[model samples]
Target chain A: METLTTPLLIRGRGVVSGRVEGEALVTTQTISGWGGINERDGSIIERRHELVGQSFAGKILVFPGAKGSSGWSAFFHMTRINGVAPAAMLFTRMTTKMALGAVVTRVPAMTDFDADVFTEIRTGDHVVVDADAGTVEVTRR
Target chain B: MHLTDTEKAMRDGAGGEAVAAAMDLLIRYGNALGAERLVETDNVAGAFNASTPSVRKIAENGMAEVFSRLNLDSDKTVEIPQMAARTCQLITGIDDQNWALQGADPQMVQMQRDSEAFVGQRGVNLMATCTPYQVGNVPTFGEHCAWMESSAVIYCNGALGGRTNVEGKESTGAAALTGRIPYWGYHLTENRYGNRHIRVEVPVRSMLDWGLLGYFTGEMVEENIPVLEGQMSGVDLVKLKHFGAAAASSGGVEMYHIPGHTPEARIADEAFGPNRAEDFHVYDAAARKKMYDTLQSAEDRKVDFIMLGCPHNSIEQVGRIAHLLDGKRLHPDVALWVHTPRAIRTVAERSGYVARIEAAGGKVMSDTCPAISRRLPEGVRVIATDSAKQAHYLPAIAKVQGWFGSLEACIEAGLTGTWKGDF
Candidate 1:
C-alpha cells in the first residue's frame, strides 16, 4: 500500500454542491439501488455484489456508479428520509440513475476526476469532498 | 446544463407552480448528469403509486403531495397538472383483487386506488403493468422516450429500437409535465452502437436458454451494449422479453443487438458501425452451465410457491402456461401466482386461459408482482419461477430460496411441492 504523509488535492467536476468530510467506503464494483440495496438501513443486499451485507450509511461512498432498476433514485431517496444516507459520493461514471440518486440523496457528489480515483483513494482513507469547489482532499494512511 | 429560452421560461414559472417545480427538478438532474440540454419526449412511463409504507406519511396530505414530494422531488406541494406527454404508469404494488393473498394493508391498498383515481384522471394511462410495450404504448423506432422499469427500458431499446435512458420517478414526473428529459446517454445516436462482441458457441433457442445467455452476457458486459453473433432458431417476443429482463437485472444493460433479430442491426459488422468493435467474448457450454447454477439461489429442494410471468406475461405465454396446468392441481403445501397485464388478462378471461389456470390452483393476478410489492404468499421459504429476472431478485428481496427453470419445470415443482431438478 502507498503511504502519504500529507493530504492530496484532486480536482474534478462537481455534480452536487456541498462540503462534507468522512472516511471513505471504496468499492471497485458498481452499486444497484433498487433490488441491490435495503434502503431502510442503507445496506447492500445484492447477493453477488462485492459490498453485500455492508452498509454505506454515514460514509463517503466511492464506487463506479449506480446500476439495476430505475427505482434507483427512489430507494436512495428513502435513505435520506430514514437518516442513513451517505455523507458524500465520489463516482467515476455517470448514468441517469446515479445523477438522480445523488441529486435526491442530497449529498456532496463529484465525478470526472483528473486521475483514477480508485487508486488515489482507498477504503478507510480520510477524505473531504468539497463539491462546491470541485475538489477532493485525500490523506492516505 | 444549457436550458433553452422556453425551458428557462418554464423554470421562471411560466406554465404553473407544478410545471415550474418540474423544470427545477429536471434542471438540477440535468446538471448532475452534465447534459447539454433537455430532449423532447412525448412518451413517458414512470412509477407513481403510493403504496409503500415510506410514502404513507406523504400520502396523508393528498396524492398531490405524494407527486410533488416523491415523484418530482419537490418540497413544495404543488397541484400537478394533466400530463403534457402521453404518459403511463409502470408496475405498481398491490394487486387490485389479490391484496388479501399478498397480505397488504387495506389502507395501503386504498392509497394505491386513490392514487390511481388521481393520476388516471390526469391523462396518465394506467397500463398498470411493467411491460407497457405489451399493452398499447409501443414506441416507434428511433423515437425518444422517458421510461422507468429496467425490463421495459431494455425491451424498448434492444427489441424495438426506441431510445431511452433508464429513467426514474422524479425525472419521469418532470418529463410528463414538461415533455422533456436529459439529452444524454442512450438518447444520443452515437451512444446506441455496440462496443462489445459476444459469440454464442452453443444453441440459445428456448426461453430458458435465451435467459441464460442474457444473464451471462450482462455479467460479462455490465452497462455496455453487446452485438451477439451466432445462429439461433425460433426467436420471438416472449424469448426476447425474457432475455432483456434477465440482462437488465443481472447488470445495467439497456440495449443489445441480436443481428437479424433486433431492429438496429442486420449483421454483426453493422452492429458496431464503421469503426467495428474488436473486443471478443465467447459463451460456451461451461459458461451456460455456470449461469444456470448461479440463478438457482435455493439450496433446499422443498418448494412452497411458484411465480410466473415476470415482465408481465404476453397472451401467448399465458396460453402456454394454461396448457401446462390443464387437468392438474397444485400441491396442498404449494401456492402459485401468474401475473399479466389487466388488458391481456381481460383477453385471457374471454379465451378461458384464466379459468384453466385457476382450475390448477394458480391465481391470475394483474397490476403487480411479489418483487415490486415486496409481498409474497404467507410463509413461503422456497419458491420456483420461470423468469431468470425474478429468480435473481426474489432471493434477495424476499429472503426465499429461489429456483430458476423453464415454465414446465416451474409448473412441475408447484404440482409436487418440491423441486425435482428434472429440467
Candidate 2:
C-alpha cells in the first residue's frame, strides 16, 4: 500500500498448498507461539521480541522459524479458530513445531527457499503466495 | 508420505470416523514435514485434558467435540475411540488439588474432572505432570515415542536415548489414535548425533550450575544437539530433568550428550559417531555469570510468589524443600507452591513431607505449574523460582517480573518477602 516495484519471483518447497495475497510481515527472528503471541488477535506478546505488540492477522507472515514450547501448533491452531491467522506463511527453518503449525493453520506456506526471503522481502510488501506452485511473488512497497 | 495398507485403510475410514480423521491429519502432517513414511509407536505423551479456557466452549459440546476439533484437527465431531497406543497426559491448566488457591472457577474445575473421566475411560493414563518419566513412563533406550512437551522431548532423547521429535497437540493426538507418527527428525538414529560441543571450564556440580550451563548451551545451539564435556558430574534424575527443561525453554534444544553418562553415548566419540562437532564453545565462569544475569528479569525487590518444581520436581526436590522450610513460615505476603507429580506427592504425603511444607506456609501441589495452568496467587506481580525453565518462561507467559536463582535463594526470598539473591 506504499510503493510499487517489479514483481520478484522466488521458489521453495510448498508444504501446505493454497493461494493468497496480502501485505507481508517479516521477522528474521524465530517466533514463539505459546508465549509469543496472543491468539485472540495474533499480536506478538513476548516482551523482548522485536515485533512486540504488532498483530500478524491477515498478513503474509515471513519469519525464520518457530521456537519455544510444543504448544506451537496448538496456539497457531487457535489463531485460525479465532479468525486471526496469517494469510500465508514463509519460513526458512524446518522443525516439527513449524511444520505441524503450518499444516494446522491451513494457510499457504512454503519453506527451504532458493534465496534468503528475509533479504528479498520486507514487511508491508505485497506478497502473492501460490503454495501449490511452490512460488512467492513479492512486490516491494 | 508413504503409508502402508493399514494406514491407508485407517485414512479411508476402516477404523471409523474419528480414527479416519486422525489418520488424515497424520498424512497431512507427515506430508507437510516431507516425511518418508509413518513409523509405529507404542508410547505417546500428549496434551489431552480440556481444562483451559480456550477449550471450555468446545468441551461444552462434549469431550468428543474438543478432541475432534483440538486434538484431531477435524471439524467433524465423532465419538472418540480408545487410544491405539499407550498414552498419557501432559501438564494441564488446572491443578485439581489446589484450584481454589489458584483462583480457578469451580465450574471449570468440574469440567476438568469430566474431561479427565472421558479420556481415562479411553485408556489414557492420567499422568498429569510434565515429567511422565518420573511417574513410571521411563522410556527404554532406543524406544520410539510420539510425545509433546519440549522438556520431556529433550529428556527422552538426551537422557534416555528414546527417539522422538517434539510433537505437538494435534499430531500427538492423532498419533495416540493411530499408534503412528511420521518417521523423521529424531526418530531415525542417524539424526541423533551431537552437532554442537560445549566444553565446560567450571565445576558444574550443583543443580544451579547444571541449570545455568544448560541455559547457555541451549541459547548457543538452539534446536540442535549439544555435547557436554568437562567437569560434568553428579547427574541424576532431578538434575537431568532441570537441565533439559532449562535448555528446552531458553532455546529449543531437544537433545544433548554427556559422553559416558548418557545411554547412547558411552564416550565422547560415541556421542558424535559418524559425525563431527560443527562448532566448539566454552561455558566458563563468565559464561555462567552471564546466564545467571540473563535469567534475572525482575527489577523489583519485593517478591510476591515463589514456584518450585518446574517440569514437576522429583521426590528428592520435594523433600529438600520440606527440610529447608521445616520451622520457618513464609512472609504473610508471599505464596509458595512446590510442584511434584500426584504419585510422588502421595509418596511425599506418606513420608510427611507435605505436612512439613504446609506447616512452613507452603503448599505441595500436583498435576500443574503456574506456566501450564497460567494461574497464580492473586496479586502476584513479582515471582522467584528455583527452576531456570520457569524463570525463562513465567515472565513472558504471565506478564510478571521473575527472578532466577538456586533453591536456597528462592526460599530465602520467600521467607523474607524480598529479593536479596546471591548468584
Candidate 3:
C-alpha cells in the first residue's frame, strides 16, 4: 500500500482545533437531511442509516456533503447544546448547511480535499484531521 | 475571496448586527467551499423554522434580545416571500383547542410571535410553505440565492439549475437580512454537475411513485448529487417539488440533476461541467419498486390520522383538496387535517374553500403541520397523507404506519378510514 503524506490539504482561517486525536466515523451518507438529527441528543435518526444510533460526539466525521434541508445546521446546533457534536468534519464538497453546522457546532472542519481521500477513507478509521493546516491524516487501527 | 464593497462593508461590521452575523456565516461558508469572495444577490429566498419555547427563550432573551437592545432592526430586510412553519403544537399544547389559548410553553409562543413579527416587520411576505418556488421566490438558472428549504435547494440546484446551498435557517435569515450568500456548493458553477449517474427503469406513473423514486434515489445517492437519467420523463414544478422534498428529507442532497428536466442537464454531459465521472449502473425497476413497497404500509389497516400539506400546502393545492372532497364526509374515527399558511387560509376562507373542506369533516388548519407542529393530536395512528414530504416525516412523528399518495386518494382514505388501495 502506498503511504501518502496528505490526501489533500485545505486551508481556511475559520478552522479551530478543540480536543484532538479521535476516531474517524466516515459516512458516504452525510448526516440527516431534515430533522433526523436530534440536537437535544446527538443521535442519528435516519432509521435506515448505517450509522443509526451512532453519536458524532468527539468523532472526526468524514462525509461527502450536507444533504436534505437547510435545517441541517440547526440539528447540529442542538447537538452542540447537548455536548455531543463532532470534534471535526472533513467534506468532499462543502454545502451551506454543512458549513453552517460547522459554525454552530463550533468544530474544526476542512473541506475540498482531493478526490482520493473520499475513496480511501473508511468509517472507524483512526485519523488525525488538523483544521489549522486543513490536512486529514488517516491510519488504519 | 472577493467581496463587493457593500459585502466587504457588511463583513467588516459597517453593516450592523444582522448583516455582520450574516457576513460571518457567508464568509465561513465561502471559505468552506473554497469560494474566493462574496457575490451580490439582490433577491434572496429563505425558509426558517419557528423555534420551540425553550429554544426561542434562548434565541429571544439570549440572542434576539441582543439585536433589539442594539436597535438593529431597521436595516434588516427579507427579500423572500415566505417561510416554513415548524410544529405549532410546541407553541400550542396538545390539549389546547385554540392555539393562542393553548398552554404551549410561553417561551415558545413568544418565540413564534417574535419570529413572525420579525418576518412581518422585514416584509418577508410569509407564504408559510416548504416550496417557496410555488409561491414566488423562483430563482432562475445560475442565480445566486440563500434558501432554507432542503428540497427547494435540490430543486433549484437540480431542476432549475439555480444556485443555492441547503443553507441553515440562521444563514438563510442572515442572507435575507443582507441579501448575500457565500458562493459555494450549488452556488459554484463547477459543483452543479452530477457526480453519480442514476437511471430509472421503473415506470413512475403517479406523483406517489415519483416521490418514491425520489426517496430511493436519495438513498442510493446518499449525500452526493446525482445526474438522474433513464426512461423517466416529464417532471413539473409540482412533481419536482414533492420529489425534491422527499429526496432532501431522505437524503441530505441540496441539488440533483434530472437529465431532461433540469436546465443544466438538458443534455447529459452538460451537467457534469468538465470533470465527468464514469458511468454508474442504472437502478432497475425492481429496485424502484422495492423502494415504493418499503414506503407503503405493509399492514392493510385503516388510517386514523389523515394529514395534508407537508412543506405546507399552497392555496391552489388546498383548493384542489377542497374541490375533491366537495360534499363527502371524513370517517368519524379519522382526524382529517389540511395545513396551509394563515394567509392562504384567509384566501381559502374568502373563496369558500375552507367551508367546503370543513363541511367534509376535514379541518383546514393553518400555522402548523405534522412535522413541525409541536405535537400530533394524541392517539393518532396509521397516519396517511398525500404529500411525500409529510409521509416521509410522519412515520417518525406518528411513530406508526404512514401512507402517502395523491390528494384524491388521501381524501378517499380519510372518508373510508382505510388506506388499502393502490393509491
Candidate 4:
C-alpha cells in the first residue's frame, strides 16, 4: 500500500474555530437510533464510549453509520434546541438518523465517503473536510 | 433502491398524505444508507423524552398550540391495548420548574407537544415510552417492526426474534403512520444472524443484571448482531427490555440473541444461521459483575431524586409499587417519580393504587421518564433507581453518584428520601 500522509480531504466551514485539527473520530460505532447524543451538551452519552466526555462541537466526526431508535434524530434536534451542536460530520454512510440530525443542526456534513475511509482515518488525527463538494481533505498532521 | 409498484404508488400519493410523506422520508432514508429496497413493517414502537413535568407540559402545551393552529382532529387512531394518551396528562399538577432542569428544549418540546397533541386529538395510539415492547407492541417472530429504542431494537431482533432496525424516531413515526420502512439495514434477512459470539460463564440473575450484561456486550461488540449462549431461561421480557435499552445505550446493536429465549436462537448454532461461529468472547461471572459495577458508584448518601421506570412502567409494576407503598408517604426531601403509560395509570387510579402511592407522597407519571428529558431535581448530587437503564443514563447528563438496587429498595429509598447504595 502506498504510504498516504494527508489521509482524508474533507471540506466544510469552520463552524467553531480553534485551528485545532485532529485525525478524525472514525467510529464503526453508529450514533444512537435514540437519545445517544446530548444536543444540549453536545456530548456522546451512549455509555460505552471511549470518548465519553468528547464533544462533537468541533471535530471531524465520522461514523460507519447511524443506528438505533427513531429518537436518534431528536437528540441532535434537542442539541440544536439547546444551541449545542456539532461543527461538522462525515458519514461513512448515512442513515435516516444522521440525515435528520443534519437537517436539524444544519451543520456542514458529507456522507458516501469511501468505505476504505474507515481504515484510513483514526480518531484525533489531522484532516480537513468540505461538505459542499463532498470531499474530505486529509493529511496526517 | 428499487421501489415496488405498491411502494411507488404510495410515494405517488396513493397511500394518503401520511403514507406519501412516510414514503418520501423512507426513500430519503434509504438513499442515505445506500439501501436497495424498502420493507414493510406491521408495527412500530416509539420512545421519546418524557422525564419531567415541564417537558411533559411543553409537550402537551406545544401539542395543544399546534392542534389549534393546524385545525387537525387529534382523534384518528385506533385504540389498542398500548395506545393511551392520558399518560402525558399525569404531570398536570406537578411543579413545572422540576421539568426545566430535565433538559427540556422549548422548540422540540413544543414540537413534541404539538405532535403528541395532534396524535392524541386524532385518537392516535399514545405509546410514548422508549420501550414500546413492554406496552404490547409485540411483533410475532419474523414479523417486521420499526422501533425507536436502540435496546428494544436489539431485543426485538435478538430475543423476540422479530425483524426490525434501530430506526430513528422520525423514521419510525413515518413508518408507523404509513406502515413502511426502508428494508435496508438490520431488517434484512442477511443481517439477521449473528456475526459475533458471546460465550457466557456468568450468573446473569435479574433484569438489572441482564441489563448490565447487555451494556457489557454492547461495549464488546461493534455493529455486529450478537448471539449470546448463556443463562437463557433466566431471561424474561422485562429483563430483555432493560437489556435492549442498556445495549443500545452502551453500543450499536440492532439485534441480539439469548440461545433458548429468542426465537431465532433455539441453540447457539442456530443464531449464527449458516455461518460458522469464529469470532467469540468468553464472559464469566466476575466479568458480568464488573460490568454492573462500572455503571454504579459505591458512595451511599441521600438522593434528592429517585426515578423508577426507564422503558415506562408496566401496570403490574406500578401496581406493585402502589401496593408496596400503601399508606406510606414519600419523604418531603425526596422527589419520587414513577414513569408509566396513561392507561396503566388509569388502571392504577381505578384500582386505588395511584392514590395509595400518591398519598404516600410519590407520583405516577406517564409519557416521560427521567432518561430523555434529563429532568432531575436540582441540588441533587446523588441519584438512585431500580432501573439499570436510568442508573446508567442519568450520570451522563449530570455529575451524580449513580446507585442501582431492587424495586423494593428503590421504593424504600423514595419513602425515606435516602439513596444509600446498600439495598
Candidate 5:
C-alpha cells in the first residue's frame, strides 16, 4: 500500500446504517433497478450503459440514483440471495425504489452527499463507507 | 414513524412473530423514506410467487422462511397470517393452468403451485394476473392501496383515481398483512397535480398510437406527472393500459392524467392546480416515429416468436387478435403467444375467440408474460411484440432481438415469419 496523506471525506445521510470497505465503482448515469442489472452475477447489463458488463460485486457501488421500474427491489433482492450484492452503496439522491433496495439488500448505504461523489470517487479507489456516521472516506489507489 | 396502538402491538409481537417481523420491516422501510407515519391501506396486491432459483431456495426453508426472507427482509422464520386488507396475487412465473405450452419445467411448476397454495391458504386472493382490476379487486376512487406491479400502480393512480406509490414486493407483502403503507409520495394529494403539460399533435387513435405516445412522452418528461391536452375522445381502458404500461416501463412515471379521460383530471386547470405548468411539450408524428425506431432492436425481422397482451390483454384486444387470425395459419417456424387475465380468458373461451386463435396454432397464456416467465423457446433469436413495454424490456432481459409494431403487424409477422411493415 502506498503512503496516504489525509484521506478525502464526504458526508451524506445514512439510509442503512453499517460500515464497509471496498473498491469503489462510480457512475454519473442512473442505473435501472430491473432489467438493467444481472441479478445472478451483479453485472450492469443495461445496453449502452457506461458501466455495461461491469460487476459491482464486493465493491462500493456509487450512482446518481435509480432509474426504471418499481421491480428494482425484487431484482436487487435476488442479488442479495445470490451473494452477489455490492458491499455498500452511495447515491447523490434517494428515491423510494433505491431506499427499498438498500433496505432489502442490507448493505451499508448513504445518499444526498454534501459533495459530488461522482467527481470525488473513481472506479478503482479503495473506499470506506461508515453509514452510521454518515461519512465516506476515500483512499486513492 | 408514528404507528397506531394496534400497529405498535403487532410490532411488539402481540399478533405473533410474523406480524411483528412485518411491522419491523415496514418501520425500517418508512424510516428510510423519511416517512412520518403509516397510513391504512384499503387494497393490496402481492407479488407473484415465481419459481426462480432464488425463490426455490427460499421455498426449501418452508413458507415461514419464504415470508420472512421475501417479505420481512428478516432471517428469522415466522408463520404468515391473514391479510388485513383486500389482497390479490399478481402474475406468477408460469401459467398455472397451461405450463406445458409455456415451456415451463415440471419441477418448477410444482414448486410455484406449492408456493401459490401456501399464500392462498393464508387468505390472499389468487388473481394470478398483472391486470388485477379486470378480475375484481379494483380499488375505487380516492381509496388508498398498496400495489406492486408498475403498470397496475400507474393505472390505479392515473385512471381509477386511487392513490398508491410503486410499492415493492416486500412492502406490498407487509401491507397485505397490516393493511398499512408509509404515508408519503402519491398518498399525499399535493403531489398528484400535473407538473408538465403535453399537447398531442398527432392522430391519437388505436392502442398502438396510445402506446407510442406514452413511450414518447415518458422519454421526453421522465418522472414528471404530465397532463395531456388533445383529441382524446375515443380513449378507452385498452388504450389507457397500453399508454400507462409504456410510460411506467420507459420512465419512473407512477401517475399521469388525461384531462376529461382519467378520473382525477376533469380539466387542464384542475390537473395542473394553481401553479403554472413548469414545462410544455408537443408530441408530434416525428416523436412517435422516433420512439418506434428506438424500440426496434433488429434490422432483419425474421421473427421466430410473436407475443401480445403484455399487462394482460382485455377482452376486446383478444377479440381483435381472434379476428385478425380468423382463418390464417401461423408460420410453422414462428410461435405465437397471447396473454390475458384468466377471467377475460374465460369470457373469450365462451365467445369462441380462444378456439379461433388456437385453431391458428396460437396459445393464449394467462398469469405470465415473457418478462416475468423469463423463458423463451431454446434457439429462438427474434421476437415481435405489440407492447412497447415488452419491446423495451425483452431485448435487455431476454437477450433477444425485439421488434415492436402494432397488433396487426405482429399478427402479419406471425403468419409470414418476417416483418412486413415499413418503418
Candidate 6:
C-alpha cells in the first residue's frame, strides 16, 4: 500500500453517485467495447491497446471515453459480475456507451472532469472518487 | 430532468416493481447522457440479453433475474413484464438451432434454449437476429427507436432514416419495458446533420467496393457523421447495408449519409447544415484499393471457415449464394455457413435455396453469426468472409487469420477450401 501527502482535488459531474478509493489507471486511448476487453479477467485485450494486459479490477479507471461498439456496457457488466470491476471510473468526456457502462456497472463514476485527467492522474496514484459531490481527490504516491 | 406524469407515475412504482425499476435505470441513464426529458417512442425495436461469461455462470438464476441485473441495473431480482412496445431479441451467444454444428456443449445449448423460451413467454418476438429490420421489425423513416447491434444501428440511422442512438443492451431492455429513451443524441434533429464531407472519386459498384469505401471512411473519421458525395447512383439496400455495417464496425459511426441516397441528405448542403462541413476528404481509387488490401489477412492460407451474411443476409443474397453453389459441393475441410434472419430463411426454405445450400454441404444458419457468438469450430486456422464487419471483428474475437473479399470470392473459397484472390 502507498501513503500520501496533501492530495490534489479535481471536480466533475458525478454521473453515478457513490464514493470509492483505489489506485489510478489512466489512458488516452479510448477502449473498444465489443472485443476490446477480456471478460473472464478484467484485462484490456485489444491488440493495439497501450494497457494490453493490465487488469482494470479494483482500480480507478481514467480514460477519455469509450470507442468501437455499443457492446461496451455488456462487457463492463460482466466485469462487475466476475468481481473484477474497477472500483470507480473517470472519463474526460462521456458517450452513450461509457455512460451506460457506468450505470450498469453500478460503480462510483464521474465524467466531464475540469482538469486534464490523463495528465494529472498517474497509474499508481491513490485516488478517491466522490461521485455524489462530483469531485476526485488524488494523492500522488 | 423533466418526466411526464405517466413517467412519474411509473417511476413512483405505479406500473409495478419491474416498470419502476426500468424507469429508475432509464432516468439515471438519461441523466448521465445529459438528457433533459424522456420521450415516448412508438415501438421498441430491439432488446438483447448479455451473453457474457458472467451471465453464463449464473444461468441457474433464471432469465428474469439475469435480465434484472444485466439489463435493469438492479441488484434485486425482478420478473420481466411484457414489453410496452414491439420487441425482438438480438443475437445470442449460441445458435438456437445449429448448436452442435458450431461445436457447442449440450449444457450451453440447453441454457440458451431455456433463456430464449423465458423471454419468448414474456412477449418478446424471438427473432434472434442482428438484422431484425430484415424480418418485419423495420421502423419507418423518422420513427424513434431503441436498437442494439452496431451494424443494425448504422443501417437504421443511415439507410432506413429511423432515429436511434447506438443503444447498449441495458438501455435497449429498459427502453423495451418503458417504450421510451432519453431525448438526446441521434433522437434530436440537430445531431443528425453531417459534420464531415467525403467525396468519392472512385467507381464503387460492387458490395465489396462499397464495403472497402466504408472501411476506409470509418477509419479516417471516427465518431463524425460523414456525408458522401459523388457517384452513388443505383446503390441498393444490400450495398447500403454492407457499407453501413462496415462503417459501424470499423469506427463508432451510428449514422452516415450519401447526399442523394440517405433520406435526410437530399443535398450535400442540407446534410452539412448551414455551415460548410468542417472536415473535407477525397476518397480515390488508390485509397479504396489500399483499404481492400488491408482487410485481407492472408492470401495463400487454406480457409477452414467461410461465413456470409454479417448484418444478416438478405433473401436476394441467400438466393445468389444458392445459385452460385447450385451443383458444386463445398470442400470437405471447409465449413461454409450462410446466415440470414429467420423470416428470410423461411422464404429461402420455401424457395428451396436452403435445400440447395444443404445439398452443397453448406449450412444456412440463423439467430447468430461467428463474430457475435465467437463460436468457430475448434482447430479452425483461417476464416474468410464477404463482410468487412466480420473480417474486422473475427480476427480479434476468434483469433483467426481473416481473408475478406466479395461474395463471389467467398463462394469460390468455400468451394476450393483456399483463398486465391489478389484483391
Best by TM-score: 2
Worst 10 residues of 3 chain B by lDDT: B86-95
Candidate 6 residue spans exceeding 4 A from truth:
A1-7, A139-141, B48-53, B298-300
Writing each residue's lDDT as its tens digit, candidate 6 over B169-266 gives 78888888888899889998898889888999988888888998889878877788999988655598888889888887677888888877888878
| Per-model DockQ against the true two-chain complex | 0.89, 0.86, 0.42, 0.34, 0.73, 0.73
| Candidate 2 residue lDDT tens string, B1-423 | 788999999999999999999999999999999999999999999999988887888888999999999999998998999999999999888889789988999999999999999999999999998999999998998999999999999999999989999999999999999999999999999899998899999999898988998899889998889989999889988788889989998888998999888888888899898989899999999999999999999999999999999989888999999999999999999999999999999999999999999999999888889988889988899999988889888888899999999999999998999998775
lDDT of 2 at B403: 96
Candidate 5 Cα RMSD after full superposition onto the native fold (Å): 1.6
Superposed by TM-score, candidate 5 places the C-alpha of residue B220 at a distance from the truth, in angstroms, of: 1.9
lDDT over C-alpha atoms for residue B293 of model 5: 90
Which regions of candidate 2 are displaced past 4 Å?
A: A1-4
Residue B334, candidate 4: Cα error in Å is 2.3
Of 1 and 2, which scores higher on DockQ?
1
Candidate 2, chain B, TM-score (2 decimals): 0.99
TM-score of chain A of each: 0.95, 0.96, 0.80, 0.74, 0.96, 0.95
Model 5 lDDT per residue over B233-298, tens place? 568888888999998877778889898889987888999886568999998889888988988897
* DockQ score of the complex predicted as candidate 1: 0.89
Tens-digit lDDT string for candidate 5 (A1-141): 654678899998999899999899989887887779999999998885899899988999999777677778888888888999999989875667888888999999998789889889999898999999999999888
> Ranking by TM-score, best first?
2, 1, 5, 6, 3, 4
- Model 3 lDDT tens row, B87-158: 111111121223542335665656666665655655566555555665566777677766666666677777
Question: Model 1: how many Å of interface RMSD?
Answer: 0.7
| lDDT per residue (tens digit) for residues B109-202 in model 1 | 9999999999999999999999999999999999999999999999999999999999998999999999999999999888989998899999
Pairs clashing in candidate 6? none
Fnat measured on candidate 5: 0.69
Q: State the fraction of real interface contacts model 3 keeps.
A: 0.62
What value does the lDDT take at residue B82 in candidate 3?
A: 26
